[model samples]
Target: MISKVIAILLYLAVVMYLGYKGWKTTQRPTDYMLAGRRMSPWVMALSYGATFVSTSAIVGFGGAAGLFGFPLLWLTFLTIFVGVFIAMVGFGKRTRRMGLSLNSHTFPELLGRRYRSSFIQRFAGGIIFLFIPIYAAAVLIGISRILEISLGVPYEAALVFMTLLLAAYVITGGLKAVMYTDAFQALIMGMMMLMLLGGTYYMLGGVTEAHSTLASMAHLMPSKLQLGGMEGWTQGARFGTPLWLVIYTTIVYGVGIGVLAQPQLAVRFMTVHSDRELNRAVLVGGIFIPIMTGVAFTVGALSNAVFMEKFGKISIAMAAGNMDKIIPLYIEKIMPPWFAGLFLLGMFAAAMSTLSSQYHVGGTSLSRDIWENIKGREASVAASRFGVAATVLAALIWAWVLPPSVIARATAFFFGLCAASFLPAYLLGLYWKRMTKGAAVISMVGGFATSMFWLLFVHLKEAKVIGLSKALFGVDSLASLAPKGSAMWLMQWVDPNVIALPVAMLLAVGAAYATQTMQREHVELCFENIR
Candidate 1:
C-alpha cells in the first residue's frame, strides 16, 4: 500500500509540474486555448493519441474486446488509417490554415466564421456542452473502478478525487496544460500497455499459444451472446445477428468515421504551427495509436483465456456480469502487486488526460463559443476557467448517478452525435467553397435531430433507459414493430451515426446547391493563406 501510494504521488507530481509549465507560458487567449498554435510535432502527436485513445478505449472498448474478441481490431485499423493519417493529411493542414484565416480559436468558432453566423457557433458549442459530460463521466467511471479495486478507495470518492485533480490543472492552464500533461500521460500509457501485453503472453506461455487457446474456446460463448449473434470470443458474431450489428456498426463504424468529426480532436489540428508538424505527427501517431488501442484489444480478449485457465471462469463471469470490471479484475488477479500499482497509474493517466480535454473543450464551448459570442462579450480566460469548474461538476454528477454500463455507450453516443452533427458542416466547410450559411445550419440541425431521434426512439440503451418507447409507443425500440427478427430489427442494433451522418452530408450538399453560395473571393480567401 505504501509503495502504491508512493507510485501514485510520483505520477501526480509529474503531471502537476507539466501543469505549472503550461500556466507560466500561457499569455493570451490563443495560448490558453491553443498553446499559441506553435506546439511541436511530438507533443501534438502524442497529445492527440492520448486524448483520442482514453479509458473509453482501454476500459470500455477493451472490455468489449473480451466479450466480442479480435474483431475489434478493425477499429484499430480505422484509428491508424482514417483517424490519424487521413484526418491529418486530408484535413489537418486545411483546418489549421483556414482557422488562422478566420481567426477562429474554437471549433465552434471555426464553423461559425465559415458560415458567418453566431448561431452556428453557439449551436455547435451548445451540442458539445450538453453531450460531452456524459462521455467525460464514462472516462471518470473507468479510472474510478480501477482505483476502487487497486487502492481500496470507494468508487464515488475516487471519482470525485480524480475529477478534482483534472479540474485543478485544466482550469488553471487550459489547453496548454491539457496537451503537455497529455504528452506525459501518453508515455505512461504506452509503457504500461506494452508491459501488459508482454505479461499476458508470458502468462499464457507465448503469443501464438495464447491466441490458439482463446480460439479453441469458441464453443464456450455465453448463451446470451450466442442468441444475440455472437459466434465466439475468438470468431466474433455471425453475420445478420444482433450482436454483429452492435459490434460492426455501433462500435466499429460509429467510432471509426466519427473520429473525423470530433471537435476536441479536430481542434488539436489548429494547435500546431504548420502542415510539416502534422506530417511529422502522422508518423508518431501511426505508431503510438496502435500501441495504445491494439494492445488493449489483444490483452482484453486473451484475458478470458488467462482467467479461465487459472480460475476456471471467463473474464466477464469473473467480473460478475459486468464487462466494465473485466480489465481491472484482470490486472489485480494476474499481474504482480507492483505492476498493478504501475498500471493503475497508467489507467489514471489515460482517464485524466482524456477527461481534462473533454472538460476543457466543454468549458470553452460554453464560455468562448456560446456565452461570450451570443452576448457580444470579449473572450475571457477567466470565463473559461469558471466554465471548466461547472463542467467538472456536471461530469461528477453524471458519473455518480449513471450505471457502469454507460461508460461505453456514452462514449459511442457522443461520438455518433458529433459525427452526425458536425461531419458534414466541417467537411464541406473545409473542402467546398459553395457551402452556404443556410446549408450549414440545416445540415447541423437535421443531423442532430435525426441522431437524437434514433437514440431516444430506436437505440435500445437510451430507449430502455429513458423509457420513452415504452411510455409513449408501447415498444422497446422505434423498430420493435418492424417485422420482428428481420433486417429492419437488425438495423435497430445499428448506431444512429450510420443513418445520421449520411443525412447530414446530403442535407449539406443539397442545401448548399439550393441556396446562394459564398462569394468566389471569399472562397479563395478561405484557403489563400494556406499556399
Candidate 2:
C-alpha cells in the first residue's frame, strides 16, 4: 500500500509540473494549438504513440485477444505501418507544411482553409464535438473498471476522479500540456508492458514451451465461440466464419484503417517544425507502438495458459465470462501488490493521456471551429476551457449511463465515422490540386450519412444497442435475410468501414472529375509550402 501510494503521488507530481510548464509557456493560440510548432521529435513521437494506444488497446482489444486470439497482432502491425509510418511520412510532412502555410491550427481548420469553406470547418467540428464523447466515455469505462476490480475503488468515483484530474490540466494548458504529459505517460506505459511481457513468459515456462502448450489446448475453445467459427485461443478463428469476419473486418480493418482519418492523431503532425522531425519520429514510434500493442495482444492470448496453470481453468471461465475483467484479474493474480500498484498507475496514465487529447480536440472543435467560424465570434482560450468542461460532463454522463462492452465498439464507431467522413477530403485536399470544394462537401456529407445509416440500421449489434431498429423497424437489423449458420446469413457482421470507406473514396474521385476545377490561384496556394 505504501509503495503504491508513493508511486501514485510521484506520478501526479510530475504530471502537475508538466502541466504548469505548459500553462506558463502558452501565450497565443499558436502555442496552445500546435505547441508553437517547435516540439521535439521524441515528444511528438511518444505523444502520438501514447495517444494512439490507450485503455482502448490495453483493456478493450486486449480483452478481445483474450477471447479471439493472436490475429489481433495484425492490427498491431497496421497501427505501426499505416497509423504511424504512412501517416507520418505520407501525410505528416505535407500536413505540417500545409498547416503552417494556411495558418491553420486544428484539423477542421486545416480543411476549412484548404477549401476556403467555413462550412467545412463548422461541419467537421460539429461532428467531432458530437461523437467524441462516446469514444471518451469508452476510455473512462476502461480505467474505471480496472480501478473498481483491482484497487477496490467505486467505478463512479474513479470516473469522477479521472475526469477532474484530466480537466484540470487540459483546461489550464491545452494541447501543449496534453502532449507533454502524453510523452511521460508513454514512457511509464512502455516500461510496464515490457515488465508484463517478461513476467508473462517467465510464468509460462520458456517462450516456445508456453506457446506450444497454448496451441495444444485448441480444443478447449468455448462452445459459444466454436459455434461462431473460432478454432482456438492460439490459432485464431477459421477463415470465413462469422467470428472470423468480425475479428478481421470490424476489429482489425475498422480500427486500423480508421487511424488514417483520426483528428486527434492527425493534429499531432502539425505540432512539429519540419519533415526531418517526422522522419526521426518513425523509429521511436515503431518501437513504442509494438511494445504497447504487440505486447498487449501477445500477453492477452497467452493469459489462458497462465490461468490454466495456476487456477486449473481457462481465462474466460476464471473471469466469469466478463472479458473486461480478464486482464485486471490476471494482473492481480500474477503480480505482487506493489507491482500491481505500479501497473495501475501505468493504466491511469494511459487512460488520462488519451482522454486529455480527446477532450482537448473536442473542446477546440466546439470553441475554435464551430463557435468562432459558424457563429461569427472570435475564438478565445476561455471559450475553449468552457468547451473542455462541457466535453467532460458529456463523457461522464455516457460512462455512467451506458451498459458494459461499449469500450471497443465505441472506439470502432468513431474511427469508422472519421474514415467515412474525413479521409476522402483530407487525402485529396493534400495531394490533388484540382479537387474542388463541392466534391469535398459531397464526399464528407455522403460518407457521413452512409456510415451513420449503416450503424443505425445495418450493424445489428449497434442497432440493437442504440434501440433504433427495434423501435422503428421491429427487427434487429434492416437486412435480416440470412440464415444464422450460413456465411451470407449474418453478412452485416462486417464493419461499415469495409463498405463506407470505399464508397467515400469513389465519390471523391468521381465527384471531383464531374465538378468545376479549382481556380488557378487556389491550386497554386494549395501547393505553395510543399513546392
Candidate 3:
C-alpha cells in the first residue's frame, strides 16, 4: 500500500509539473486549443497513440477479448493500419493543411469553414458535446476498475478522484498539457505493457504452448457463449452466428471503421506543423499502437488459460461473469504484487491521457463551435475552462449511471456513431471539391439520425438496454417482430455502423449531385494548400 501510494504521488507530481509547464507556455487561445500548432513529431505521435488507445483499448476492449478471444486481434491490425497509417498519411496531411489554410481550431470548425456554414459547426459541436460523455464514461469505468482492484479504493471515490485530477491539468493547461502529459504517460504505458506481454508468455511457458493450451480448452467455453457460437479462444466464433455478428460488426468493423471519424483524433492532426511531422509520426504511431493494443488483447485472451490453470475456472467465470473485471482481476491475481502498483499507474496514465483529450475536445466543441456561433463572438478562455469542467461532470455522471460490463459496448457505440455521422462529410470534404454544403448537412444529420434510430429500435443489445423500443413498441427491438430465421431478424445483431455509414455516404453523394456546388473561388481557396 505504501509503495502504491508513493508511486501514485510521484506520478501525480510529474503530471502536475508538466501541466504547469503547459500553462506557463500557453498565452493565446491557439496555444491552449492547438498547442500553438508547433508540437514535435514524437510528442504528437505518442500523444495521438496514447489518446487513441486508452483504458477503453486496454481495460474495456481487453476485457471483451477475454470473452471473445483472439479474433479481437483483427481490431489491433485495423487500428494500426487504418487508424495510424491511413489516418495519418491519407487524412492527416489534408486535415492539417486545410485546418491551417482555414485557421480552424476544432473538428466542427473545420467542417463549418470548409463549407462556409456556421450551422455545420454548431450542429457537429452539439453532437460531440452531448454524446461524448458516454464514451468518456467507458474510459472512466476502465480506470476505476483498475483502481478498485489495485488500491482497494471504493469505486465511487475512484471516479471522483480521477475526474478531479484530470480536470486540474486539462482545464488549466488545455491541449498543451494534454499532449505533454500524454507523451510522458505513453512511455509509462509502453513499458508496463512490454512487461505484461513478456510475463504472460513466460508464465504460460511460451507463445506456442500458451496458444496450444487455450485451443485445447475449447470445451471449457461457457455454455452461453458456446450457444452464442463462440468456438474457442484460438479458433474464433462460428461464421454468421449471433456472437459472430457482435464480434465482427460491433467490435471489429464498427470500431475499425469508426476511428476514421473520431473528433478527438481528427483534431490531433491539426496540432502539428507540416506533412513532414505527420510522416515521421506514422512510424512512431504505428509501433506504439501495436504495443498498447496487441499486448492488451493477447494478455486478455490468454488470461483465460492462466486462470483455468490456476483457479480451475475460465476468465469470465473467475470474475463472476463481469467481462469488464476480467483484465483487472487478472492483473491483480496473476501478476506479482509489485507489478500491480506499476500496472495501476499505467492504467491511470491511459485513462487520464484519453480523458484529458475527450474533455478538451468536448470543451472546445462547446465554446469554439456552439457557444461562439450562438453569441456571434469568440468565447473567453474562462468560458472554455467552464466548458471543460462541465464535460468532466457530465462524464462522471455517466460513469456512475452506466451499467456494469458496459465499457466495451459503450466505447463501440460512440465510435460507430461518430463514423456514421461524421465520416461521410469529413472524408468527402477533404478531397471532393464538388461536395456541396447541402450534401454535408443532409449527410451529417441523416447519418446521426439513422444511427440513433437503429440503436434504439433495431439493434438488440443496445435496444434491450435502452428500452425505448420496449416503451414505445412493446419489443426489445423492432427486428424482434420479424420471423426469427429471416434476414430482418438477423438485423437485430448487426451494428448501426453497417447500416448508417453506407446510408450516410450515399446521402452525401446523392445530395452532392442534386445541390449547387460551392463557388469555384471558395473551392479553390479550400484546396490551395493541397497538391
Q: lDDT winner among the candidates?
A: 3
Local distance difference test values of all predictions, in order: 0.91, 0.89, 0.94
The per-residue C-alpha lDDT of model 1 at residue 64 equals 87
lDDT of 2 by residue, 87-148 (tens): 99999998999988888989999999898899999999999999999999999999998888
lDDT of 2 at 388: 84
Q: Report the lDDT tens digits of candidate 1 across residue range 233-330.
A: 77888887888888888888999989998888999999998888999999999999999999999998999999999999998899998889899999
Show the lowest summed lDDT stretch of 10 residues, model 3.
Answer: 378-387
Cα lDDT tens digits, model 3, 1-531, are 899999999999999999999999987889888999999999999999999999999998889999989999999999989999999999999999999999999999999999999999999999999999999999999999889988899999999999999999999999999999999999999999999999999999999999999999999988899998999998899988889999999999999999999999999899998899999999999999999999999999999999999999889998888888999999999999999999999998999999999999999899999999999988877888888998999999999999989989999999999999999999999999999999999999999999999999999999999999999999999998999868899899999999999999999999999999999998898899999
Best candidate, TM-score? 3
Q: Model 1, which residues run further than 4 Å from truth?
A: none
RMSD of 3: 0.7
Between prediction 1 and prediction 2, which has the larger lDDT? 1
Candidate 2 off by > 4 Å = 483-488
| Model 3: lDDT of residue 442 | 98
Per-candidate TM-scores read 0.99, 0.98, 0.99
Ranked candidates, highest lDDT first: 3, 1, 2
Candidate 3: stretches off by over 4 Å: none
